[model samples]
Target: MRVLVAGATGVIGRQLCPALVAAGHDVVGLARSAPGADAGLAGVRIVVGDALDRSSIQRAVDEAAPDAVVNMLTAIPPEIDPKRLAEQFTLTNRLRTEGTRNLIAAAGGVERMIAQGLAYAYDPHGDGPANEDAPLWRKPPKPFVPVLAALRELEQSTRDAGGLVLRLGHVYGPGTIYAPDGSLLRQVRAGKMPLVSGGAATFSFSHTVDIASAVVAALDSDEAGVLNVVDDEPARMSEWLPFLARLIGAPQPKTAPAFLARLAVGSWGVAFMSQLRGADNTRAKNALDWKPRYASWRAGFATELGGLAAADAS
Candidate 1:
């Protein structure tokens, strides 16, 4: 099987490409820059193209001529210029909404397509762990309206195209927001990260490797539609934040009042930092026969932090 991975140099893509190759599939990695930009991608056939640019995307896909197309493109990170920040929603929305369009269009002969979505955007109904069938909140009270609206568009776009939408959990890995030396970790180490009042928000987190594996599984499966690609246990903030601090040997976060958190982090951040909602991956496991390699957040969290600690000691 020949596989085309757009955004092939992304955190998840970085792992997915190698996994696909190791599984005996020919892998083509598409990125915005030259092939050598990705360090561990030595043997991968790299094509340079910006997914936002439909022509470039089409050309890359046409050249790869893969049996399946994996749309892994997402633009988010340290590039925080005010203008870019303003376009953050637009850029990523286009990547999900429009970029997927171009990839599917270009994959004229491809059998399957795997696209990205967010599991957290589901309507926060009364719940311990929400499954794939849970209702999505297109408009929340205030701050979430715009964000959820964009997410809704992304999901709808993929659904309309009949592509597999993997509503990925919050990605934290080597090149992501929680990278060993990244902002979140730095905050924790510096004691800048504080726990919200109650600190009971449950977050469903998935390891980058697990996410990559799920993508690999999607390519070979006939099943399609939305699936939650997340860990078995979604840890509450009270549990995970302090646990993360302990793992990093950092000071435990100070418990701030929920009102203060709402004021400091805004209503949106407060909801995310203090709510309880976890996505269930039973559908993926049952249908695709895919169980996450990192079954629990405890395992994944330890792995990430342990790796970081080792790197620091070295």
Candidate 2:
């Protein structure tokens, strides 16, 4: 199979491209910026193109002429400054929404298409282990509105194109927020991150390596629709955050005054800390014949954090 990975230089892309190549798929990666800036994506044929630019995307798609196309682009580590939220969300939204439009148009001939979506966007007013059929948050508080709106657009576009949407869990792995130099880890290390309110928000975490594998599996299948790519167990913020902090040798995060957090991180941070729902991966497991390498956060969290700590300390 010949695969084209857009955002192939992103956190997950850096891992996915190599996995695809190892699986015997010829891979072509789209990059708008400097080539090989990402550590693990060296062998992929790099095509320069910003996913938001229609012409650039078309050219990239034409160059690869892939049998399958995977839309894995995202603008993450978003600006922490509240003033920049709108603009940052809009830009990242384009990668997921408009960028997806361009890719679908460019990949009309491809047999399979796999797109990245968020599992965390579901309405938080529910029980744990929500399935794909659950209702997405319609009135996401202020800052998240643009992001969720874009997510809706992206999903609609992919569904219309008969593409598969991988509504991935909050990704945590080598190149993700749990990485030694990642923003979240730095915040945790510095005691800037905190558990807002009770910290009972359910978190659905997916390892990057597992997500990369799922992307490959999605491409290999003819099944079209949405699947939540997450682990077996969903963790509550209170349970996971402190455990993660302990593993990283960081002081336990202090509980932020909920109102202050709302003012600072905005409603977005509050929702993550107090309200989000965790996704169920039963569909992906049964349909794609896939299971996460780390079924529980407990199994992998310590090892993952320990390695990053060792590297950072060294």
Best by TM-score: 2
> Please, what are the lDDT tens digits per residue for candidate 2 over residues 130-165?
899999996787888888888889889988888999
The CA-based lDDT of model 1 is what? 0.77
- Per-model C-alpha lDDT, please? 0.77, 0.84
Model 1, which residues run further than 4 Å from truth? 78-87, 141-143, 307-314
Q: Candidate 1 on 19-133: residue-level lDDT in tens?
A: 8888888989888887565368866898787777789888887788888878777777643322233345566766766677777777765777778788877776656778988
RMSD of each: 2.7, 2.0
| Model 2 bad stretches (over 4 Å) | 78-84, 307-314
Worst 10 residues of 2 by lDDT: 77-86
Give the 10-residue window scoring lowest on summed lDDT in candidate 1: 78-87
